[model samples]
Target: EEPYVAVVYSDYLHLVCSSCFHEDAPLLIRKCKEAPLEACKGCHEVYYCGSACQQNDWKIHEAECKFLSTAVAVPSDIVRMIARLLIRRKRGDHDTFRAYNGRKFDDLMDHRSDFENMGANFDKVFNDTKNYVSIDYMVDREEIVRYVGKLLVNQFAIRGPVDTCIGNGLYIGICIFDHSCQPDLTRRSIGSKMILRSQNREQTLNKNLTVSYISPLACTEERRKLLRSNPFFFHCKCRKCEDTEQDGYARSIKCESCEGGICLVKDDSAPLRCMKCGITSSITHEEANKWNADVAIVEYFGSEDCALFIRKSMHIFSPPNMRDLAKKQS
Candidate 1:
């Protein structure tokens, strides 16, 4: 059960339960002990799980319903979310919220400065969010800006079983997790809640917990660029970003040298290597044979030596000026 739950407009909410966020909300709601969902007459677009859910959600949705019942350009998703949060705060389930983020909401990371660093186009986006607030919500523009930044950096997209995006939600408790190019945690949303389990949930405790914010299928540079743009304004320095070999195999191909081996970014400068055979189509036989001599030594070497040797091999096999190997394969 969530301390709080919020849903988008009914058109977007669709068959999903507005209160609990269940996909089969309408069908399951029919089996409820309570009366059926109350559809708002104003728009015939809003529905609630029950009377209590209707009243609770109505506290915020009323204004939206009335406004939406009429013709107006629908607000951006972020603007609508900010509006909902403002009204929900007034309903005031203070104690329930205190358990997370110390309930300040202010304690949430501020991406305002991050946007400032990005320059004026970001400022325009922030300004556009503010423009949506003026007549509908009597809110402080600065407060809206802060919440907008928080939502951008913190909200998690609610995905269906097939990885289709169902909606988006914000959970203060789970937002504290730092991201990695290769995540240790996998996110699964059940209705309104975001659950993080160990990528290997069988074992618990501390084992380098992490989660990927972007697809690891992209090569290192692509992931870094995506993370540094818009919402996430920082370049990733994760191990995978530093070493291209960590690229996920979804984008990889079968190696010519060893048909069984996956050809992946083994050299940061250019060549793709056969993971099992340690052979590269781009690396000449003479060079590969020489490099292969160090494999046993690399295996026995300390972590620091292994890293250095790998870098040396990359420089030797694919000079820095050469084009990226993954792009060529793509």
Candidate 2:
């Protein structure tokens, strides 16, 4: 699938082939050609393996050349990405580019109101966009803001074969897949392209495919917090997000009544009920905060003794609590 717009990060300008976005390695770089990489005569901001590669990307880069040539410094990854998108939209690229299901670029979701409610955060982005993008390429102020919000929420990290992030891109089809903490599909990247595959035989017949937008290893609450921030400003209603009992088990407290653990009950303000012994235990806010802090310290510091001490204090949820396993092995 072709990307609607993509830009290699500034830090990787020289290392990656801007046109093909081939991985940076001696052998791979040599595979393209031993000839020294060429920089755009106008901007010197992008690099290509050879003239042919440069020519291939020239269509998109042509619009950016003039702006980049006169700029004081190279724009940021997101900034450059947004500029390319704006240029494409102004030139009517959105009308011709379609997803697998024939969804046009204009069909993409735009959370303009959400960004508007963001106040100063949204203001900074809008101002930065205006500063970098030339006046000729820009649309009305509201239209630019709408595109900015759309790109923020829909852009994907262009990662290389080894799973190293090389750039950012906007793919119309990939954007259609919704986010889930527990996804039914697996995704891998090759250069500027992404490949999604069903995880199991059952998933092949499934209609509602999903992929993790955030790290699945993170606790449910942490994942939810991230999903509700900057790029994704919506609460998740995935199976994992709705599993309140499972979430409580992850942060369970020790129950003194039956030497069992008591998990926090979702949507209930009363005392927690022990999952094992059916006894109620009242815990203070301070206690919960302390437990969370201790877990964080052990995870960050990787002190085996500290982990063991914490492990003995509660009934840890299995598998996801790999730290406990490591502590036990230690």
TM values, all candidates:
0.65, 0.71
C-alpha lDDT score of every prediction, in listed order: 0.57, 0.69
lDDT of 2 at 37: 77
Candidate 1 positional error at 249, Å: 6.6
User: Best-fitting candidate, measured by TM-score?
Assistant: 2
Residue-level error in angstroms, candidate 1, position 310? 30
Per-residue lDDT of model 2, residues 179-291, tens digit only: 99767665555656666766365555233778878665455667788999877898988876799766555555666576435555343455666667877666653455355
Writing each residue's lDDT as its tens digit, candidate 1 over 101-123 gives 45445557868888768762444
Q: Least lDDT summed over 10 consecutive residues: which range in candidate 2? A: 316-325
Q: Mark the regions of model 2 whose C-alpha exceeds 4 Å error after superposition.
A: 27-31, 34-36, 120-124, 201-207, 244-330
